[model samples]
Target: MNENLFAPFITPSIMGITTLPIIIMFPCLILSTPKRWIPNRIQTLQMWLIRLITKQMMTMHNKLGRTWTLMLMSLILFIASTNLLGLLPYSFTPTTQLSMNIGMAIPLWMGTVLMGFRNKPKASLAHFLPQGTPTPLIPMLIIIETISLFIQPLALAVRLTANITAGHLLIHLIGSATLALSSISMTVSSITFMILFLLTILEFAVAMIQAYVFTLLVSLYLHDNS
Candidate 1:
């Protein structure tokens, strides 16, 4: 029972073939096209969502930062799709894995930092020490700022992993309880099932919100550097 309860979080494999890549690519399939002059409802909605997200993400960015529109938009869509897909029955949530999240966060985060250093070395270094810092606290402030800078990516990974994991675990626990109680007390089981239903709805919103938050933070970081 315990194993079954935690089974959803496990990275699934069949004959040593991992499903992570397949799940990640599933979202992109929705965006496929066959050269139609006028898009249907689904295609039109998808295009509208893409444009809306792109506009909001680029709002705070400069002309230089606008170059990242495609990358950032793709990221948000991928993450949003992955999170929504995980809510499906018998599906695995890849974002719940810290390694996967960290793997993504580090490289992208580092790229922005590297871009800053390459293009604006003085400005990037200047971030370590604010203007008019006290003489005695300058060294300590630099150390603190440096540590904070490195922690950003780590925080991003942990935040995504922890939120998704917590939501999945809660849903699992409540669902299991609902099933167990159903045999003993129909009334209590019904109430528990209702709660589970509501929680599932909340999780759906959480999934989208987290994806947006992740992409928004990355865009803010890019704006800072660019």
Candidate 2:
């Protein structure tokens, strides 16, 4: 049972085909390209959402970081889509894997740090040493600061992985309990199903929020460096 529960997280190696791409395409497949002169429901909703998301991502990035709207938007969309799709029956959540999260985080985080170093060398270096520090504690402070600096990417990766994994695990356990209770007591099973339904809804919200948070953190990192 535990193996079946975690089987989705395991990587697959297939010579013929894989369901991963199809699942990833699910989000894009639902919305069509706006072709009509007067936008329909999906088009209108997409346009409005585009404006809202762009504003959220770009408003604070008025400086050199303004150009990153596309990249950040793509990141958010990818994470959100993967998360939401995983809610469906038999679907897998790639973001739940620590390796993939770390892969996404390190390069972006490194880019921000490199940008800061390139543009503001002294400022980047200054992060390692506090102003007006005691001479004796300087070494200790530098070590602490350096450690903190390097921990940023790991923190981002673990944060997203932890939240998504926990939410899915909860949903899975509750769903199993609902099925198991059906034979014992119809009343209890109904109650459990209701709770499971509410939890699923909450997980849906969590999926989007975590994606937003991950992208927003990346944006903040970029803003600081820019």
Candidate 3:
């Protein structure tokens, strides 16, 4: 496999096509679902777990529907797992590459905007352009709203790209430093190694958090627009 850090970003077509795995992974759940009225023990357990979590959240508040939440959960798990996988030595961080992450973010942003507009055609415009603006400011408001609408995908792309890239770079730098220093001074380099080891845990947390943030923001976008 190509180990070049920047190569994937340069040729987007290669990384751009990676979204297929995510789609294929999630959509395949439908096939595993039982068609008959009766479900096996494992399937029943999964359904119960989903329902239990759904009910608990619904009891607190009803902002997000169960079905959407389930989809969001799947997205979170997929992203988190992919990110963690990339953290392993020599593995490519798909999320670290702008092309891959942006490819994913763009579709997500497009889906959210398309669904929101379809669900609320009138309010879609109004959501972008608020209702209380005076006639004189309508054009200005429209321009602002248009800019804001356009920035959604851009924001998603930059956010994921920056987070993952920074993280991977930090890990690489620390590991390299530890490697270089370990030969001359074991004590100092060991400390650095320990810190880098701790950083892996932090990276794990960040990976999970980024995944949740992405899904949560997507959900909020859908909820607000819907």
Candidate 4:
């Protein structure tokens, strides 16, 4: 059925109000909390991974950009967790929702833009007008660049939503087909099931990569502005 196929993407509700906030916070509960003084194995590994990722992400930025390491790392972890958790049966993927993605994208993207303007107004404005442009094309180029600048956040939101949605839909379709074919041809059904298993593994990787890509793009934007 339609309900079963679409279930993974549908936001749950109780008494007509959405439960998206609960779903979004579920990942935080799953993360191991750090202890004071004596750290457990999980906490130690978590700290090490955090430091490694932060160091690599901040390598391109100056000291000012490094200040955002915490925010960027948090963003990536939250996204990656939500994505992977959604793979659980009967769970919804918040990143597949365009509204949620846009809400996250706009504020973060705007913060970077505003930071650029506040810290280096001349350099920020200079992005709209490339150097060595012919005088006649300057106005046209400025207009094009200006549009592209404003579209970055929208692009980020759409990109995340589309990729997540596509993967979920494909999995749902293949899973349904695998079930339906079981009654017809056992061999074909088995092959389809194997494909489904591989696709699931691929999706797991995609979820993590998309989160990293989103965070990396934000860091690149920060670097440009900084």
lDDT of 1 by residue, 1-226 (tens): 1466666777888899987888778878866563789988887888898899898789888888899898998898888889998899888888998999999899889988998998899999999999999999999999999999999999999999889999999999999899999999999999999999999999999999999999898888888888
What's the distance in Å from true for residue 6, model 2? 1.4
Give the lDDT ranking, best first.
Answer: 4, 1, 2, 3
Question: How close is every model to the real structure, measured as TM-score?
Answer: 0.95, 0.91, 0.73, 0.95
Candidate 4 local lDDT, 61-167, one digit each (tens): 99999899989999999999999999989788899999999998899899999999999999999999999999999999999999999999999999998898899
- Candidate 1 accuracy as TM-score: 0.95
Instruction: Please identify model 3 stretches exceeding 4 Å from their true place.
Output: 1-67
Clashing residue pairs, backbone N/CA/C < 3 A, model 1:
none
Q: Give the residue spans of candidate 2 off by over 4 A.
A: 1-3, 12-31
**lDDT string, candidate 2, 1-226, tens digits:** 2548776676554775765666566676665678879988878986787689989788987577988888888788889988998899977888898988999999999999999999889988998898999999999999999999899999999999999999998888888899999999999999999999999999999999999999999998998888
- The global C-alpha lDDT for each of the candidates, from Candidate 1 onward, is 0.90, 0.87, 0.71, 0.92
RMSDs, each prediction?
1.4, 2.1, 5.6, 1.4
Worst 10 residues of 4 by lDDT: 1-10
Q: Of the candidates shown, which would achieve the greatest lDDT relative to the real structure?
A: 4
Name the lDDT of candidate 4: 0.92
Q: Residue by residue across 1-226, what tens digits does model 3's lDDT show?
A: 5355454333233545655455335434443467789998878986785576445433432453335676665676567767777787646556666666678777877776887688678878777677688999998888988998888877877897789778887887788789989999999999999999999999999997788677766766666665
Error of 3 at 122 (Å): 2.1
